[model samples]
Target: MTPRPADQRFDVVVVGAGVIGTAIAARLSSTSARVCLLEATDDVAEGASKGNAGITSSYYAAPGTLESDVIATSYRRWDDVCRRLDVPFRRIGAVMAALTSDEADGLPGELANAKACGVAASIVSGDQARRLEPLIGPDCIQGLVLPDEGIIDPMRLCVGFAELAARNGVQVRFDSPVIDIESQDGRVVAVITPQARIETSFVVNAAGLFADQISELAGGTNFKMWPRKGEYWLIDRDWGRTLRHIVFAAPLPDSKGIHVVPTTNGTALLGPSVTDSDRRYDKTTDAEMLAHVTEKTKRLVPSVPMDRAIKAFAAIRPASEKKVRIEVDEVVPNLVHAINRSTGVSSSLGIADRVAELLAGAGLDLTVRTDALDHIPTVRRLLLDPEPETLAALDPRYTQVVCACEDVSAAEIQAALEMAVPARSIDGVRKRTRATAGRCQGSVCMAGVTFMCSLAQNRAPGDVVVTAAGTAGA
Candidate 1:
């Protein structure tokens, strides 16, 4: 692979392209901060951000922490971001269902904690739970309803933020993994990567699971985070609306337990059984975990048949065995450490705003920025509207259905291929246009999008890759 030139510097360098890193990069770009976002993978959100259940959580957070503040505010902020980006989001509530006396008795503490954290949560009986989610097992004895909880497509959210950041002149470098952090006198000087060397004054370590390594590279690794792998199962779109909200089991010391989430893309997701693992990037879903997850999920929603599960995957959650760590590096004066929290997704946007505010407080002039960053992504009405006027207004390609399973049109795929950071691979196209992520799982549409990306990018089919590693052509 040819290395790209990095003849430019920036005010800040965010060393990860996970959900948190993307959000921070996008937010920081709103200022005069010349920012560069670095990612190890070829695309954003290929790590934990891609898999796992994509639920937008409330401050189900433990109270009196920076995370709680951001998580609480982010729940609302995410709703607005999703709207403006035309990213599909569902305001589906979440339920913490209890099936036993012990579980039911433990509910009050969760409710009180939620209230103390200023989250809107209520306790409900089995009948109420059934009424809220009719497919839930009749054995459910009690539950807590979190009305503001939501589900977001993580990849789309990351992509939207990236596109918006690019619109504001922030350079996001894919496949640029920071090899070293060049610093002097406990202040950031530059980030050294194989492809580019980004000179920066401030650095943000939002590398998700590998954040520890990035921190160590930057001369600040006072904390350590272990990876807790969570496996997930995806049901067919036919069972999409069977559940009105995200359903959960009460939290255990190890993990949040299994959840049944109806995603924004009209499909039901299950599992996410948390298990300790040493592998940082082990995304393989284990059979034992799958068996346990399938059994536990059936207890919550009996009608969800295991045979209908089309995809089972895994994501690693960064957890600290010591304590949740969120602090500016004491050793490094200009660096802020935001790493090792399991619920980072819930607090990502809020974390970005807080980091920016902190930098401003530290005498950084973050006020200077472009006049207005326009981020209104076009919503293709081809799938949403079949009316003649709507169809006519869209390029004639709107009439051409490219991926029938997800209702993705040729116009959408073409636009995705031509966007700020064009979809180079099949999964890139999937992230932008939802091409091969449907029930058929790329069996039918893979060839079409791959060929289109190859033709549009003027690359031979051999150059085209699918998903993360596998190749489709040549």
Candidate 2:
């Protein structure tokens, strides 16, 4: 690992590369400030951003709260942001079904919350809910319809932010974990990593699960973050194609309950059983938890094809005493914290704006850059295009499909490898191009994808790893 050149000072250094941090970095890039985004992992979206349900909820937060405010603002801006970045986002809407009268009684409260938050919501009878989604279980007695709720690709969302930030002159340094935050006279001075010592007056602690640890290094408030694991099951696209909208059980006191979501890429997402745990980085799924997920999901949408389940994974959300904390540090000057449990993605754009405003009020320059790029070229996906012959004529590599399950071409893989924030591993390329994320789960296309990655990295096929420090030839 080579160190960043000496005397590289930045106006602001943002820690973590999750959706929140990347969003802030991207927003800050619009200014003339010299900004740098630091990530402990080899690539972005390696934490809570990579896994978890991808729904952009319209009214998940309580009214008059910071989360609700951000969610409302983000809901309005999400479509434009996705279009500008060329990321996949769909406004398919969502239905929260109630199987019992007791549950139905809670619908009024939810409807009120939606009204207070300015989110469009309506209460529908069970038959009306069935008309909206025929596959909903017969046990559903009533439901709440949220027409603006949608799903998005979390990987593309984070990657687009980072790529756009990089295009606008924001330096992205991967594999750089902050070892210490030096302060003098109650103000941040420099950030020390093993590979570099960056001089900066301000630092934003958006480190997700490790935000508390990062704050401690900066001598900020002592906030503890516990990990809450959410396990998910990915159903095959063949079954997902039948589902027209996101279906959910009524919200519980402590959790959102299980949901059946039709993702933007045509696959269905289910589960996310919230379990309180002490382990900070435990992402392992258990048989018992997964079994509960299938049972609960079936209760909501009995027609869901559990037999077509293709993958099971887990993500850890950062649970804090305060449900969400997004404010400048009280004790440490020039330091900010953006922490949340499950609504980070849905609230990211608003979070970025608020963080930028805070930085400006704190005396950081917010001069607009005239040469900043506004958009990046959308990667050409064969599955999305209607005429393959037209694309094949432009680049012969477009015709050479590498991952048949995903219809991903060699050209797309190579294109991802050459992006502003280029892919460094097979998983990186998967997040960018969906090369090996299909029904087969890479069993059929792993070899071809690995060979391509090997060629891209100038390494032998046997030595290729899925991600940084991951298993070779996985």
Candidate 3:
């Protein structure tokens, strides 16, 4: 890899390209700040952002906590934010179903918490729960209806934030991991990566899983970080179309319990059994855990079509002593720490605004930038309207169907590769266009995707890796 020219200067440097970091970068760029966003991988959302169920939660945390505040703030503006960013969001609402007396007992308290948090929620009878979600088990005793609970495409949200930030001239560096932080007199001055040393007025530590390392390296806070693995199954739209809203079993103190969630792309999600793991990057799915998840989810929706499942995967959220921290470091005056174990997607917008306030308080000029762009150009998806004659008229490549399962066309694949934060690997293309993410899971379309990636990225077909996880192309 080539090295960046030495010692580039910026007003701020955000340390990760996950949703939190990207959102912060996007928000900060709307200022006159010369910002830089650094990521370790070839593309964004390589961590928990890509792996988890994309639910933009609104009612999970305690009403008075920082987590709840951020989530509540973002929840109010979710529709506006999604519209401007062109991210697909569904405020389809969610139902927390209770099957036992103990579970039913918790619904009133949760409803009260929701009210205090300014969320619209109500307790309902078992019959009402079954009526709202026909798939709910007949055994459900009670339910809590949260009308503002939403779903969002985390991949697209991160992509949108990165693109908008880039549009505002924020320098985004991929494959650039911060190796060191240079500070003097308890103030951060520079971030050292393998390729460049970026001088900055302040640094935002939003590295997600590896955030502790960043905080420690900056001589700031001392916090430990680990992975809490959650495994999930993705079902095809055949079964996905049957679900009307996101379904959840009454929450456990430690976990949200197993959920039956629907994706924006018309697929269903199940499992996501939470297991505490010490491994920071272990994403392997377990047969026992998956079995547990499948059985638990069935309690909420008995006919959870396991046979229609297309994929099984796992992602780990950052777990630490502090569940969430969004404050300036005590030891280092200019190092701002932003960490959230879960709900990073739900609270991203509010977190960005808070980080902006922290930066401005620390003496950075965050005057709203008039020149920054508010939106990116929108593209008409061929698959969304796959009228062959009409689509082929707009672009010849629209006629060339690349992924039969998702109906993704060559035109869409080309356009994904041409985005501001372009896809460079087969997996990147899948995230952008869903080419290999359908029923067959790339078995039928990997070659075509590899070819398209190779052609657009200007590499030999064999040179492109099948995934960012170092799976070499065959």
Number of the predicted model whose lDDT against the real structure is largest: 2
TM-scores, one per candidate? 0.94, 0.97, 0.96
List, residue by residue over 1-474, the lDDT tens digit for candidate 1: 232344677778887888788888888877877788888888888877777577888865578876677787688877678877667777788999999999899899989988998889899999999899898899999999998888888888888888888778888888888888777777777788886667777888878777788788889756676788888888878887567888898777656788889987778888788777677767787888898988988888889877777788888887665334556777887787666456667777887888888777666778756574746576564544547457645588877777988888888889888877667688999887788988889899877887888889787776788866877764
C-alpha local distance difference test of each model: 0.79, 0.89, 0.87
Cα lDDT of candidate 1 equals: 0.79
Which is the leading candidate under TM-score?
Answer: 2
Off by over 4 Å in 2: 1-6, 471-474
Query: Can you write out model 2's per-residue Cα lDDT over 258-309, one digit (the tens) per residue?
Result: 9999988888989889988889868899999999999999999988887899
Q: Candidate 3's error at 212, in angstroms?
A: 0.7
lDDT of 2: 0.89
Weakest lDDT window of 10 consecutive positions for candidate 3: 379-388
Ranking by lDDT: 2, 3, 1
| Candidate closer to the true structure by TM-score (higher is better), 1 or 3 | 3
C-alpha-based local distance difference test score of model 3: 0.87
Q: Between candidates 2 and 3, name the one with more favorable lDDT.
A: 2
Pairs of residues clashing in candidate 2: none
Alpha-carbon RMSD to native, per candidate: 2.8, 2.2, 2.4
Tens digits of per-residue lDDT, candidate 3, 289-398, equal 89898889888899988999998999999888888889999888899988888889999998998999998998988888777898876655655554556887788898
lDDT of 2 at 213: 95
